[model samples]
Target: MSQAALDSLIRMAPVARKSAAEMVVEKLLELIYSGSVKAGDTLPTEQELSAALQVSRPVIREALRGLQILGVVETRQGGRCSVTDLKPSRLAAPLQFLVGLDHDNVEALYEARLTVEGELLALGAARADEAALEHLEHMVHEGHRLTTDPLAFRVMDLEFHHTLMRLAGNPFLERTAQSLYHIGAEVRRVASETPGVLTNSAREHELILEALKLRDPERARRAMHTHLASILRTTREAMQQSP
Candidate 1:
C-alpha cells in the first residue's frame, strides 16, 4: 500500500466509542500518530477545536487538560497548545496516584521493575559510554555514602537505576523504567527503613556498577538479577511482618 493510504487507514482505525473526553483523547492521539500534528506543532485553539469538532469549548478544554497531564500536549501562556514528545515517565504520576488509591500490592510493581530494569541493564551495558558509566559510578558512590540513611539511599538507588535507563539510549525503555521506579518508590521507602536494607542496597549498587564498568554483559545481567532478588525477598518479609 502507498504510504499515504497506510497513514489514512491508521488515522481512520476504530477506536473505543466511550465518553466524549475519551473520544477527544483518541482523536488527538490519531492526529499525532498520523503526523497531521507533528511534535512542536501548535494545536488549534480551544475555540477553534470546539468549532471544528462541533464540541463545546469546556469539553475541549477538559480534554486538552487531560492530554496535557499525560504529556501529550503543552499549553503555554496565551492559550496556545502544542504537541509534545510524551514519554512513559510522564505516566508515572497518574499511575502512582491510581495505584496508591487502590492499595495495590508491591509484588506487581516488583515484577514490572524486574522485567524492565533487566532489559534496560542489558541495553545499557551494550550502549553505555564513558560519561554514562561515570555517572552510574558516581550514583553508586553517592548511594554508598548515604547507606546510614535509608531514605536518602532509596532516592540514590532510584537515580542509579534511572541513570542506567538513560544510558540505554531507548526512550521507551526509559519511560517504562520511570513508571516502574515510581510505583516502587513507596515500597522502596519502607524497605530502606528496615534495618540493614540500606547497607545491602548500597553493596548491590557497587556490584552492579562494577559489572557495568567491566562491560561484561552476562555479569551485568547477573548483578541486576541478584539485586532485584534481594529487594523482593526483603519486601516480602517486611510485608509479612506488617500488622
Candidate 2:
C-alpha cells in the first residue's frame, strides 16, 4: 500500500449504516470506476481497508471474495488482491454459466446477436483500419481452405465472428458478442456437422469479408443480415429435430 492508496480511502465518505460487506463492494467498485484504483494496482490490505472503511475485517473478506467471483478483482496468495484487467470479455464467464443453464436462452441469444451484429458489421466495414481488414481477410481466406474440415472450420467460424466484432471498435459491443459467441459455439458445433452447412458458411463468410474489404457499410450490413438470417432459420429447424 502507498500514500495514494490511503488518500483514495480518505476521499470516499464512509458507509452510512448499510450492509457492511455489500457497501464495501460498492465503494471498492466506485474507486475502480473513478480511477482511484486501477488495473495492476494492489488493493489496500485487509487491515488497511477495515481501518479506513471502518468496517470489520470479516466484512471486507466477504466482499473481496465476492469481487473475485465477479471478475472485478483477483485474489492472490498471501492475502494480496488487485484490480482486474477490466476487459469486457471477463464477462464471458457469467454468460457461459447462464447459457449452459437454459436451453431456451440459446435462441434468445442468437436473436439478440443477429439484431446487434448486423450493425456491428456495418460499423466494422466503415471503420475497420487497414490492419483490421487484413486480419479479417486472413481468417476468411483460411476459413475457405478448411471448408471440408468441420472441426477446424468451426473454430475458424468463431474466430472470424470474434474478429469481426472487435473490428467494430466498440469494446462493449464486442464483449457482448463474445459472450454470445461462446454460447453459439455449441450451436455452431451442431450446425457445422450438418451436410452442406460449412460450405455455405464459407461462402457467406467470403461475402461478408468482401463487403468489409470494399469498405461498403451497406453491403456489409446486408451481407451480415442475409448470413445471420439463414443461420437463424437453420437453428430453428435444428432445435425442432433435436432431442
Candidate 3:
C-alpha cells in the first residue's frame, strides 16, 4: 500500500472503546473543525453517514441531536443537517443548564462580560468610524430616554454595549460579545428589575458614549469598567435578595 493509504489506515485505527453515539459525535466534530465541513454545508443523509461510519441510524440521529443542541448543526425534518454559524445564542441552553446546577456560574459569566466589554470599548474608541459612532450615539440616546421603564432601559443598555462591540471592527470580537450578551440576558433582566439599577445603568452608558464620542480610549475603557462593575454589584445584590 502507498504511504498515504497506510497513514489513512493508521488514523482509522480502532480506539480502545467509545459508545456508538459518542463515536459519531467525535467524527462529526472532526469533520467540522477540519474544514471538511464548512458552515452552511449540508451533511450527508442519516442513512448515508450511518453506512459510511458503520454506526446505526439511531446513533447518528442522537449525535446530530447533540450537535444541534450545541448550535453546531441544524436539522430539518426529512432533510439533512447543516453546519450552523457558531453564535452566542447557541450557548443559551448550556449556560442555563450550568447556572441551574452551579450558582456560581452566574457570577463568572458577568465577569467575562466585564472583561470583553472593556476591551471592545477601548477598540471602539480607537477605531470606530463615523457611522459606528452615530450608531453608538443613537443607542445611548435611546437608553437615556427609556430610563423610567426599567425593562426597556435594560434592552437599550444591552444594545448600546453590543453596538460598541460592532464598532470595534472585529468580527470575532463582535460575535464573542454578542454571545456573552445572550448568556447574560437573564442576569441583566434580574439586575434591571432591582430598584434604581436602570437609572444608574443609563447614566453609566451616557458617560461611556461621551468618551467614545471624544475618541478618548482611556476614558472609554474606564467608563466601561465602571458600568460593568455596577452591573456586577447589582447582580450580586439581587442574588442575595432572591428568596
Candidate 4:
C-alpha cells in the first residue's frame, strides 16, 4: 500500500475502555474491512505499526497474535504477517471453543442454529434441484441404518445438515452451520445413545427432506425448527445424565 493509504489506515486516537491491544485489533479489522488492507497483503512491520498506531511494540504484537489465533492473519518466515484468505471455515474456527465454554452456551448455540439453519434450510428447499433432493433422500435412508451406531449416526446427521447448507449455496452460512452442528459433539454422542434418539432424528430428517422435496421453504424451516428442538431436548437430557 502507498504511504498515504497506510497513514490513513493507521491513524488512531486513544480509546479509554478497552485494552490498547484490543483497540489495535479493532483498528486493524477496520482497516481490513474498509478495503485498505487486502487479503494476502503483508502488514506493516512491527516497528512501523507501533509507531503508526502510537502504541507500544508489545501492544501491537499482542494484537497481531490475537488476530493470528482468530485466523485473520498468518505469520510467514522471518516474522512477516499477511492477511489470510479469510475463508469462512478458517474464520469460524474459534466458534468451536466459544460454543462449549459454559452450560448456558449450549442453549444459546442451538438458538443461533435455529435462526441460521432455519433460513439455510428454507433456501435449500427453494433452491435445491432434483440431484440435491435425491442426494438428501439417500442420506435419510442411510441415517436409518446408522441408528444402531451412535457415532456413525452423528457423523451422518452432521453431513445431512451440511448437505442442506450446501444446497443453500452460501459458503459463509454453510461453514457457520457446520461449525454450530459440531459444537456439542460429546453431548450429542451421548444423546445418540438414548434408545430412540437416533431413530427419532432420522425420522426428523425424513420430515425435513419431505418438506424440501415439496419445495416448500416455509415448511422446510418449520421442519428444521422441530428437528432442532428435539435434538436440543435430548442433548440437555444427555448433559444431565453425564455424571
Best by TM-score: 4
lDDT of 2 by residue, 1-243 (tens): 367867888677876567888889998888887777788788888998888888888898999987877788887777699888888666344566455613667567767877779889989988899987788788888887998899998777878888899888897788777776676556566777788887888889989989998999899989998898778766666666668
List runs of model 4 lying over 4 Å from the truth: 14-18, 54-58, 86-93
Candidate 1, 1-243: lDDT as tens digits: 134533453445443435766777777777777776777777777765665555677777888888887788887778798777555555334566445511356667777777888878877787899988888888878887898887677677777877887978887778767766676465556777888888888899889888888878778878888998998887776666666
Which residue segments of model 3 deviate by more than 4 Å? Answer: 1-22, 38-42, 52-54, 69-71, 76-78, 84-102
In lDDT terms, how accurate is model 1?
Answer: 0.73
Per-candidate Cα lDDT values, in order, are 0.73, 0.80, 0.73, 0.86
Cα lDDT tens digits, model 3, 1-243, are 133322332355342236877777777777667666677777777876766676678888988888887788897566778888766556344544333412577668767877888888888898988887787778777876786787778667767777788877777667667766676566567778777777787788889989988999889989988987897787677676666
lDDT, candidate 4, 102-175, per-residue tens: 47777898899999999999998889989988889999999999999988887788778878989989888887
TM-score of each: 0.79, 0.73, 0.78, 0.88
In every candidate, how many clashes are there? 0, 0, 1, 0
Q: In terms of TM-score, how similar is model 3 to the real structure?
A: 0.78
Ranking by lDDT: 4, 2, 1, 3
Residue 199's lDDT within candidate 1 is 82
- Model 4's alpha-carbon lDDT is 0.86
